[model samples]
Target: MSGPAIEVDDLHKRYGDLQAVAGVSFTVERGEFFGILGPNGAGKTTTLEMVEGLREPDSGSVRLLGESPWPRNPRLLPRMGVQLQASAFFEKLSAREQLQTFGALYGVPARRVDEMLELVGLSDKASTREDRLSGGQRQRLSIACSLVHDPELVFFDEPTAALDPQARRNLWDVLREVQARGTTVVYTTHYLDEAEILCDRVAIMDAGTVLALDTPAALVRGLQADTRVALPAGLLSASDARALPGVGRVQDGDGELVMSTQEPARLVQALAERDRLDGVSVRTATLEDVFLHLTGREYRA
Candidate 1:
């Protein structure tokens, strides 16, 4: 509470010969909506578990709310909440019943349970059994259970992993509202678009190390990645596209001409001057571009 809500230093975790997390360190400011992004098996879950006190690191240290998370600190338990990537619920329990059960575990009052169910927009389905709820509803119930105690800091691991597009957006709105109320949130996901839209700052991780950490806009801009221009195949020869003002790289693939440029307006003007603007469209670089730049195109586990 006085310093960073979460602090990790020289963290290392090894599973036999496989090093899941290696010498990682970072700080999460109080009340900041932070994101940890990486592909599967990038040690994201391992790192988070260590911070949440769910797993002890082989080496290094973690402090949650200024107290050590290892050895199962009881004081931190009351001040923190976590929603795992996958959660199992008692199928026979109603939405309201489930939250009440979790609330009792933390000595939360019955009023708090009701508040949480309504906060996650599950009020109308409060009586529905867990097994009868939709996937999105179950997810919301998971979130509601995590917050039933009103913990100051919350952690979510891939909270929207398998949700439909509409459900994802709806949950996003719920998260935004949570941030508005001043609770610090740490979220992890491989979804670049979600991190870009939801997090105030993101740490990009790969191979058990953080490759980059900053605001999504700053990270993407720091790469100096070019704005991409796409055109129909044969709209202009590859040579002509490459020769265009401000263009940097030209790639011809699948009957389309794609090129990168720093100056989209200038390139557009030049193409228009040549009467070659048809089928041309420009797109700005995104966090996905930054991720690929840092981690390379190779697939990871």
Candidate 2:
């Protein structure tokens, strides 16, 4: 395979005595939609800022498309697009005017502004002042401004935060369209399901440390041995269920029993032989389960 589009080696950052990012390292391949997932204050934003050349790391290094991120290289700036967690704009500027200003900075043609507005579903709002737009509409405009330069790579930080479900879905579709065009994306969000659906691979981070890195399917498979199988009532007690073939653990709850095992198929067949199984349901491991198993806590907490 070709070298990574983005690479970091033992990346570290500090805020006074606090070590915000501690030796985190990962690589994002070209055209890959990579996600960085973590709870609040997990150093996710700090890490991304360092990668985007907005902040200097206290130690370690970052390489963006084989070039150093520091010193804010002018040539590299136009090739990258960034949408911060919190964005600001001239409140008096209309959407079209704002896009025009940024377009001039990148030396892009004025026509590109209208194209991006349409791409992000903000064309109708082009004449609206930034302050008059709703939060979701402003976010869409921010995304549109980021793409006015037609960058090859984009960094989206919590792009769906604070939006209603419908608006969030709209943004998700827009992002899908961006990816379909072969532009690489590095996304950071608290939404695990979004990451699962949109990202080709992800790196789970906490307290500046990388807990896991892999495709969502591969990460979930690592917990396959802890798979759960739920069986219906009057079937088996906890102890008897544990004694069943391939059953590693079993817990009875009223009319239902949840059995955890490395070999669910064997347990199912064994239970079937005794006529003790009814309405059985097997749940394969999921990304959320892997996050909880590895971190011993909920993701949003």
Candidate 3:
């Protein structure tokens, strides 16, 4: 309790010739919402699995709640909950039944099942069979099952993958509620925006290594990536935009024109004078920009 909720030191994993996690290390503070972010095959899941005691690391150490996880420690499992990337459920089982079953395994009270269902917004569909629930509803049930025992630490791997925008937003609220109740959450997702808004701190992983770990704002600020200017496409030629003072990079983002500039005020004034400020908007670098800068690739692919 005095130390970090989770501590990983020089963790490594290998699958034959493939090295999944390579000497990764980080700490999650007590009750903090920590996120692991990366593109596909970045070893985020492998690292999380090692820390969760679900898989053995090739070398190094992991301490969850201040105890070793690799040796299959009994004390660690009950105090920690996990929602894997994919969960299996009996097609015929009701959502409530599924939670009740998991609760019984954890020796948790049946009342806890109802509480979890309500917490994850599944009470209305509590009686719906697993096969009958929508993707979002099923995902909520998966989350409810993980929290049925009220573990001190929870690990979620891509909890919002494949969800629609609205469902994803709703799940974000559920995760916020979970954190509000004082549960330390270790989450992994490909969604950089989700990581930006949800995580207290994030570790960006790639090629079996942790590229950077820090608060979202700190990471973006570290880049010193200039302010972003957005406006309708074709407002200015790429060459002319680059010719502007303090402008660093000009990108055609979809149909909108985006440019990075250090002197936002000057850029705004210039655009206004040129009648190019009709739909212009100025903002700071986002987590997505930072991720792209660090990895030299898009977060999605």
Candidate 4:
């Protein structure tokens, strides 16, 4: 396989006495949509900032497309785009003007501005001032500004933090378009559902370290030891269900019998034999489950 488009090796960052990112390591292959997830103060922002060259790591290293991410290499700055957690634009500047100004900074042609506006579905708002646009529109504009120079890799920091459902979906589509164009993306978000839907692979970080890193499916399946099987209320009693093959625990709840097992197929078949399975629901597990198991905290907590 080719070397990763973005690579971090034992990255460490600090703020005075506090260790913000501690020996975290991961890689994003070229053209892949990678996600980083964590709660507040989990060092996610610090890690991303280091990779984006907005901040320096106290130790270890980060490379973007095979070069150091820090020291702001002039030749490399144009090949990368970034959407900060809090985007600030000149309030009086029109969307078109903002894009043109940013384009000039990267020596990008003015035509690229129109292309970016269209790419983010903001072409109709080109004449709108930054302060006059709605939150969602401004967010779209921020994304468009990042791509004005057509960077090969883009870093998105909580890109959908405050958007409505439709706006968020629009952003997702835009990101999909970016990926289809073969741009590698490093996305950090608090939304696990967004990560599940958008990322090819994800790294779950907390307390300055990665707790798990894998494709969403694989990560969820890794929690199979606690598989949950939900069947209709009258289907089976807790005691009878526990005696089934591979079922280690069973609980009655909310008009269903919840069974936990490492081998769901065996338990499922056992339950099926007695005509005790109805409205059966089997889930492979999820990032939320992994997060809960690993940190002893809920995914949203």
Candidate 5:
């Protein structure tokens, strides 16, 4: 409460000969929205589990809410909530009943059940059975279950892993509202763009190690990447775009001529002066660029 909400130092975990998490360290400030990003098998979930006290680490230490999380500390359980990647529930239980069941575990007040339903946008589907809910709706229910007892710190493991685009965006609003209410949110996700917009700071991990850790803006800025200027394909050929001022690299993109430049404003000014501004679009470096830069574009398991 007085210091950081969560602090991890040199965390390590191994199964057989494979190292799942190697030397991971980071801190989550009170009321901060933190993100852990990595490819599949990058140990994001394992690191989160160790921090949540659900799994024992092979080395290093974790201080969660000013107390050790190992050995399954019961005192900390009530203050923190964890949503696993695979949500679990009774198929026949309605959304309301599912939440009530979780609230019962913490001896929460009866009114809290309705509060969670509304909080996760499940009030209309309160009577819908768990099996009947859509993938996004069920994911929302899992989140509501995690927060039924009013946890101060919540951990989400890829809450929007497989949902449709619109649903993923909708869940982002709910996550933002949770942090707005002063709850510290620490979650792992493969969605780089989502983390770029939602997280206060992020840790990009690969091969069980943290490659970069910083705010989304900071990470992108540090990349020192180029800005992309695009124009209608027929407006200019790749050779002509290459000759334009401030153009460093030019390639023919799908239906457009893409030109990369460090001086975007200068390039735009040049284009404007040339009366070639039609259908012009500018693309700046993004967190996805930083992520792909850190973890190469190669396929990952």
Candidate 6:
């Protein structure tokens, strides 16, 4: 019903001899879960900073909520929430106190502070000092601080970077709840699976430019990769698998027999005919495949 919440057009930035961000452009619709995925030094953070008005772009334009983000626009500040990679909390402040201080800046009421603590699962750690909290709890506190003002658009830079798997999943639930409340979420992550599960659409960046931009499923579909079907070891020999109607490549994986084929249906039917469907597992084209196809396997600086 309204224009896009964010519109970035041909954004460019450079540092000394390095072109940090070059001609990156994309749009984020209101209430959309948009993810910027890339490896280290892919200019994801630089592009995000330019969009958040923290850095000046050498060229191009960014319209956030229909307003320019550059020059540290005061009018847009209250409407945006930014959670940087490094969390900063007031010295000696407890979790609740940290949120209280942030809420005070936005004139938010006390009840909202309680709600934020509960929302981020920080209610129990409300009295814990920032320095005394665990890495996960501190990360949650940083998120609570950014969201205490109830901004419409939230930006998170690798929010789950160093957390354990369990904590990362817990934060995923919290993020889902945030999006459920109609907040536009724009985040950057190195985890391809996480992006596929969380984002409605994603932009994959490399060498300071967008290499692929689309829904995870759409991008994977475009790759046209052969499906991989894995069967239990000792179920069939390699020669038999290779002789199947649609099987292309057969390989022996750890305790499993993996086969690749374009016509998975025909192969599966052939396996079924032989009564070898006991431990069959199928993996179709995935976001990881699409990411690698675009960004390649080279290490980034």
Q: In order, what lDDT does every prediction score?
A: 0.90, 0.86, 0.89, 0.87, 0.92, 0.93
Q: Could you arrange the candidates by TM-score from highest to lowest?
A: 6, 5, 1, 3, 4, 2
- Residue lDDT tens for model 2, 216-257: 989988766477889886677777887888887778877789
- Residue-level lDDT of model 3, residues 1-301, one tens digit each, is 5889998999999999999999999999999999988888889888888888889988999888889987788988789888977999866899999999989988989889889989999898988899999999989999998889999999998899999999999999999999999999999888999999999999998899999999999999898878989888877888888887778889976888888888898888888888888878888889988888877765454
**For residues 1-301, what per-residue lDDT tens digits would candidate 1 score against the true structure?**
3899989999999999999998899999989999998877788889999999989899999989999988999999889889987898876999999998898898888888778877899989999899999988888989888888888899998899899999998999989988888889999887799999999999998889998999999998898878998999988989888888999999999989998988989988998898987887888989999988888888665
Question: Which residue pairs collide in model 5, if any?
Answer: none
Compared with the true structure, what per-residue lDDT tens digits does model 4 show for residues 1-301? 3678898999999888999999999999999999998777788888988888889888999888888978977767888899987999976899999999999987888789999999988889899889999888888899888888888899999889888998899889998999999889999887788889999999988899999999998988787657788888887778888788888778898788888888888987887787766689996677877766776674444
List where candidate 6 sits over 4 angstroms from the true fold.
none
On a 0 to 100 scale, what is the lDDT of residue 236 in model 4? 76
- Which parts of model 3 are misplaced by more than 4 Å? 233-259, 269-276, 298-301
User: What residue runs in model 2 are displaced by over 4 Å at the alpha carbon?
Assistant: 1-3, 231-257, 264-282, 298-301
* Least accurate 10 contiguous residues by lDDT in model 1: 292-301
Q: How many Å off is the CA of 50 in candidate 2?
A: 1.5
The C-alpha RMSD in Å for every predicted model, in order, reads 2.2, 3.3, 2.9, 2.8, 1.4, 1.3
The C-alpha TM-scores of every prediction are 0.91, 0.84, 0.89, 0.87, 0.96, 0.97
Error of 1 at 138 (Å): 0.7
- Best by lDDT, which number? 6
Q: Which of candidates 1 and 6 reaches a greater TM-score?
A: 6
Tens digits of per-residue lDDT, candidate 6, 1-301, equal 4899899999999999999999999999999999999878889999999999999999999999999998889999889999987988899999999999999998999999999999999899999899999888888889989999999999998899899999999999999999999999999988888899999999999889999999999999899999999998999999999999999999986899999999999999999999999999999999999998888898766
> Any residue pairs clashing in model 1, and if so which?
none
Rank order (by lDDT, best first): 6, 5, 1, 3, 4, 2
